[model samples]
Target: MQNFDYMTPTRLIFGKESIVKLPEVMRSLGKRVLLTYGGGSIKKIGLYDRVNELLKDFEIFELPGIQPNPKYDPSVLDGVRMCKENQIDVILAVGGGSVLDCSKAIAAGAKYDGDPWDLITYKVKAQAALPIVDVLTLAATGSEYDCGGVISRTETNDKVGYMDPLLFPVCSILDPVYTFTVSKKQTAAGCADAMNHTIEQYFVADSTLLNDGFCESMLKSLMVNATKCIENPEDYTARAEMMLCCTYGCNGILSLGNSYSGWPCHGIEHALSAYYDITHGEGLAIITPRWMRHILNEKTIDRFVKYGINVFGIDATLPKQEIAEKAIDATYAFFESINIPMHLREVGIDESRIDEMAHHIAVNEGLENAYAPLTEEDIKKILIESL
Candidate 1:
């Protein structure tokens, strides 16, 4: 096993009626609050009213319309401005990963004297950040539990994952009931996102059997519960399981002794979402299977065989290459079965910017050092294959 250090400081208030604790949690943090959200889904689901009722005693400021992929310029800049101007003591991010992600950047940026992009791009390390509390409405990205957020710079078509210890939320409120109204498309995409997170860690070199089994179990649970969620959006059992799976996805716990994967699928999909403004999870779903196929070879075939037999229940006695191929095919079929686009063109991407995206990913994402080491050519080939 590889040597590592792991700690999760974010306090989780889970299950139904967890929102009632919001007042106590926020009061412990501060009075002046910047409430952040995406679009008006919270309002549609009546979460906005509930949160407002809880925060009625505290001074509140609002920053809404934080979009998916969480753009850096307007959302981050506006949020930082709101925090600084209002002298906000804490941030209550009340939407999905994007809202919490933007809130994190805002928390860091509000304390800095320079541009927020400096902290986001790692030009300057954060000394301290405002406290963050989140009510998670989406079960993907695991931003509520992790210290990193992927922020986009739209002008440059750049999506960067920024991690700072200070960015961890002080606490997170997770009520799976909030996700009961999530659309079928988003639920499937969230499943794909969480699965990719585990697979990324599982495929790395120097992983322990314990960690591999943990990942395999997570994948199976996500697949089963995701289908259940799609069939009946309000199924509490499925929603709760899926929510917990996503919560554990990107945090360091699942891969404590595993070697770094370099997260190459995320690297490539970052470019896709940054360029096309597609859903982050859908972009990952489209790229994952193709990347899997491209990276498969004699040396890596054994890992695929294990994944096939363990995760997908493929026949163990099958020939080595066939097992590997079946695993890749199973992955593709799973995504397709969930109604993911399964191709770049199906999501409005074409060959026009394939070279550009490949070069961008190679130059910016550092995927050359990934477990399977994708070069610019390798990235282009995967993009073409995905198309």
Candidate 2:
């Protein structure tokens, strides 16, 4: 096992009726609140009214309409302006990962004088940030439990993953009830996103048996529960378990004491989503099997064999190479079974920008050092295969 240090200070209030405790948790952080969310889904679900009623005693400033992929422009910039102008002491992010992600950047930007992009790109270290509290409505991204987010700059075609210890939410309120109304499309996409998160951590060169077991179990749980969620969105047990798996997905718990795999799929998908504005998880689903095929070789056969046998229950007596190839096929089949568009062309992403995207990912994502190193040509091939 690799030497490591870990700390998770985010207090989790999980289960039914957890949102009722939001008022008490928010008081400890501050009385002045900046409420952030995406489109009016929270309102449609009555969570918007409920949150307002709970925080009625506190001063509230609202920043709504934060989009998927979490734009760095108006959302982050406006959030920072709101925090500064209102003297907001804390942020209450009330939607999915994108809302919390935008809130995280805003929290840090509120305390910085220069452009927030500097802090996001690590050009400047953040000295302080307004605290954050979150109510998770989507079972994806794990932003509530981790101090990192992916922010997109539409103009620049850049989607950067930003992490800072200061951005971890002080508290996260999770209730499976809030997710009952999520569309099947998003539910499946969430499953794909969380599954990829575990796969990224599991495929590393060096890892502990304990961490490997954790990753395998997480992948199975996501697949099982996501299927249930698609069939019956109101299945509490399914939603709850799926929600917990995603919450743990990107929080470092699954990767601790393991060597980094460089998260090359995410590196590749970032460019796809940045250029074409595709759904994040759907892009991952489309690219992962292709990347798997491209990187499979004598060096990686063992890892894939184990993944096939353990996670998918493929017969262990099969030849190692066959098991690996079957495992990759099974992965593609799962995403397709869940009705994820499974192809770049299906998602309206043609080959027009494949070269540009491959070059961008090679230059910006540092995938050359990934577990299975991907060069510009290698990435281009993967992109072509994805199409």
Candidate 3:
């Protein structure tokens, strides 16, 4: 175990009808509200009307169309301008991770005197931020529970994960009913995203048994519930479990005393999504197994063995190497079963920018310091294998 200091201050109002609490939560935070969302899906599902009805007393302003892989230029900039102009007291992010992520950046940027990109790129640290409250409609990225958000600069083809404790939402309303209408594609991708988050933390150099158990159980739960979700999107029990699992994914709670894995999969996948505008979770699913295969060696075999045996129930009596390989195969198969494109080419990425992406990832994401220390060449090879 490693020395650590941890706290998750995001108050989770979970279960059915949790959105009803949004009014009281927002009232406690402030009066002037910046309501953020993406693509008007909330309106289609009637959540938009319910939220408006509940918060009819508050001074509300709208910042709609916050896209996935949230952008910095218009969304973040416009949000900061709105906050500054309106003297916005709190932000109500009412969509998936993208909206909440954009809201988080806006929350931090509203208080800063400099460009929001500077804060996102870590050119400067944040001192204070506007309070954030979220109603989560997607069970991915875990942004509602974590202080980090991945934002993209489309012109520059740069996606950066920004982290600051002040960026954590003050409260999150997690009603699985909100996710009942999630498309199968998104639900599977969300499960892949959550699984990748856990595996990133699990495949570290040093970890406590407790943390390992947590990771393994979470992985199994996500896999099982994800399949259930794909089969029947209206299965509230599975949806609820998967939602909670993903909420716990990136919140720093599961890996409390574990050594850092440097989250190399995310580090690499960021480039794919940034460059190709690919779906974040689909890109992660495509990269994860290949990265696992590339990093599997004598030093990492034990971790793979445990993951195989515990999570996938691969026969523990099998040869160690066989077990590890089977585990990796099982991972790839799981993603394939969920209908995630298992190749970069399938997602419209090809060799043309493989070198550029590898260099970008090596330079920007610092994968050289990852648990297995992938070099630029290693990244290229993984990308090729993924293709």
Candidate 4:
């Protein structure tokens, strides 16, 4: 086990119609607000109107069209400006993880004088931020319960993960029914994202039995319910469990008191998404199995063996190396079985940026201390093999 300090301050109200309490939550944060969302999905599903109706008593300022891999330009910059200009008291993110992510930055940026990127890049820690409240519409990213969000810079092709204790939502309302329209592809990708979150923690060199069981249970739940969610989008039980799994995915609960693995998949996929702007989770799915195979060693094989036998039920009698290899195969096959494209080419990532991405990871993501300690050359090889 590793030495650690942990805290999650976000209050979760989960269930059907939990969103009806939106106004009450907002009331605590004051009146003027910035309503943030992505490109019109909420409108299509009548959530836009419902939110407008619910906030009829409070002043509303709209910030629309936030994109996935949420950009820092219009969403964060514009939202920060809006909050400052309108005297906005509370920030409500009304879309998936991307929108909520953008809003979290905006909530902090509104209070800062310098560029928000300074806070995001860790040039300065965010000490104070406007309170954030969320009505989650997707079962991915777990941005609601976490203080970290990934923001993209189109100008530089950089996607940076920003974390601050001040950025945790004051309250999050999770209604599983809101995710009923999530496409099968997104559902699978979302589950993959959460599962990868667990695997990242599970692979650590320093770990505890408590966290290991938490990660394994989360992995099993996501793998089992993700298919049910895809096959029947309206299945409330599957949707509820999967949503909760994702909400708990990345907030350090599954990794509490655990040593870091340096999150090697993230170290690689951040380059892929930052370079080509591919979907974050799918990029992770593509690189994960390749990473596992590349990093297999006696030092780490025992973890893979445990994962194989415990999570996937591979026979414990198998040889250690074969068991580890089988675990990697099962991982790739699970993503394939869910119909996710398991290669870079399938997701419009071409060869021109391989060197560029490798260099970026070398300079930006710091892969030197990864679970397997990948250098730029090793990263290039992993990318090539994944390709």
Candidate 5:
């Protein structure tokens, strides 16, 4: 096992009535609340009215329309302005991970005197941040439980995953009931996102059996429950389990004592999503198997063999190479089965900028030092193969 230190201070209030505690939770943090959200899904789901009723005593200011791939320009900038102007006490992030992510950036940016981009890019470390309390409505990204958030600077075509302990939500209300209405496409994409989170950590160079088992079981649960969710979106039991799995996905609990895999898949997919504004999870699903095929070799065959046997239950007696290849195929088939676009073109991404994206990823993502190190040419080949 690799040496490591871990801490998760976010208090999780899970289950049906979790949101009822929102008022009390925010009470300790502040009276002036910055309510952040994406689109108007909360209103459609009645969560908007419910939250307004619950926190009626507090002064609330709104920052709406935080998009997926959470942009830094307007959302983060506007949020910071709102916080500073209103002297916001705490942020109440509604909607999904993108809202929470933008809120995180706003939280940190609210306290920093420099450009918020400075803090996000690590040009300056955040000394303090506005407290955040989230009511999670999506099961993807795990931003509800993790301190890190991916923020994009669209002008630069950069999506940076920023992490500072100060950015962790003080409290997260995870009421699975709220997720029962999530659409079928989002449900599958969410499962793909969480599955990739586990796979990134599981594929590391050094890991314990305990962590591996945690990942394997979570992947199995996500697959089974995702199928259930697609068939019946209102299946409370499936939604609850999948929600919990995603909540744990990026919080480091699943990868404790595991060597860093450099999260190569995420590294590559970040560029794809940043440049194309594609669905983050769908981009990952499209790139993952191709990355797997490109990286498979004698040095990494053992992990693939174990993944194939333990997770997918491939015949143990098969040759290691065959097992690895089958494992990759099984991964591809699973995403296809879930109805995610398996090819880049299917998602409206084409080869026009493949070379540009490859070079950009090579320079910015630092994937040259990944678990299965990839060069610029290697990345280009993978992108081409993905197409």
Candidate 6:
């Protein structure tokens, strides 16, 4: 195994009644809270009122309307402003990954005087940040447990993933019952997103039996439970398993000692989501398999073979190259089976911006020396094939 250092400081409170622990976690965090949510869905599901009732003792300020591919504007900017003006102490993210992502940005921004984008883009690093506590209402993106968040700047079509240990929530409360109401579209998208997270790590140029088993188990659990979730949204077992899968995704547990993947699919999908405001997870699902087909070669066949045998139970005796190709095809078919749109045009993206997307990715994501090398031309080919 490669030499490495690892740390996961976030406290996880998970179970059926974990929401009851919110007030105590908030007590350790701060007194005045900056409460963040998206589009009022949490309110529709009565979570807003529930949180209000539970936190009746604490002072709260609201930052609503955080969107998917959560933007640096309104959510982060307004949140920072609220923090500065009202002297908000800690941030409480109360919706899905987008809300938590925006809250994370706001937490970092609230403690800095510079533009948050500067921090998000790594133009400046955060010296300190407001404490964050989250109540997860969705099972994707894993922002609850990780120190990274993807934020968009519409003016520049830039969607950047920002990471700083300072951004991790001091604690997260996960009650899977909260996700029982998520629409199937989002349910499938969430599963696909979480699955892609593990696959990205699993496909890297490094190997360790530790992460390999974790990746395979996480992948199979997500796929099987996600399908069960689609068939029955209120199945607590499926929702719990999926929520756990997403939590494991961005938290670095599945990638310890693995080589850097450059997260090429995420880099490419960021362009689509940032430009068109597509659902981040759905965009990833649509682009992933196509990228897989584009990148498969003799150099990368074994990882695919192992993934097929371990995760999907493909026959091990098949030709190795054929196993790899079938694995790629099975991946594409899984997204299709979940009703995720499998092509860019189907999602309103087209070839016109493949060159632009490629150039932007080259400039932003630094995919030149990724695990599988991808030049701008290579990125364009992948994008074109995805289309």
Please provide, for model 6 over 1-387, each residue's C-alpha lDDT reduced to its tens digit, 9 standing for 90 to 100.
667787889999999989988888888767898899888779888889999999999999998888888887767889999999999999999988888888889999999998888898889989999999999999999999999888888889988888999988999999999999999999999998999888888888987999999999998899899999999999999999999999999888987888888888888888889888888788898878887887789898888899989888999999998898888888888989989988888888988778888899888887876778888888888888877
lDDT of 1: 0.93
Model 2 RMSD, rounded to 1 decimal: 0.5
Checking candidate 2 for backbone clashes, the offending pairs are none
Tens digits of lDDT, candidate 3, 1-387: 899988899899999998877877887788999999999799999999999999989999999999999999899999999999999999999999999999999999999998889999989999999999999999988999999898999999999999999998999999998999999999999999999999999999999999999999999999999999989999999999999999999998889989998899999999999998899999999999999999999999999999999999999999999999999999999999999989989989989999999999989988888899999999999999999
What local lDDT does model 5 show for residue 188?
A: 86
Give the lowest summed-lDDT range of ten residues in model 3.
20-29
User: Please, what are the lDDT tens digits per residue for candidate 1 over residues 1-387?
Assistant: 889877889999999989999999999888999999999899999999999998999999999999999999899999999888899999999999999989999999999999999999899999999999999998888999999999999999999999999999999999999999899999988999999999899898788888889999999999999999999999999999999999999998889988898999999999999999999889999999999999999778889999999999999998989999999999989989999888889899999999999999999989989889999999999999989
lDDT of 4 at 353: 82
What lDDT would candidate 6 get against the real structure?
A: 0.89
Find the number of clashing residue pairs for candidate 4.
0
Candidate 2 structure quality by residue, lDDT tens digits, 40-110:
89999999999999999999999999999999998999999989999999999999999999999999999
What is the alpha-carbon lDDT of model 3 when measured against the actual structure?
A: 0.94
What TM-score fits each model?
0.99, 0.99, 0.99, 0.99, 0.99, 0.98
Q: Measure candidate 4: CA RMSD.
A: 0.8
By TM-score, the better pick of 5 and 6 is 5
- In candidate 2 the C-alpha lDDT for residue 122 amounts to 100
Candidate 5 backbone clash number: 0
**122-217 per-residue lDDT for model 4 (tens digits):** 998887899999999999899999999999998998889999999999999999999999989889989999989889889988888898899989
- Misplaced by over 4 Å in model 2 are none
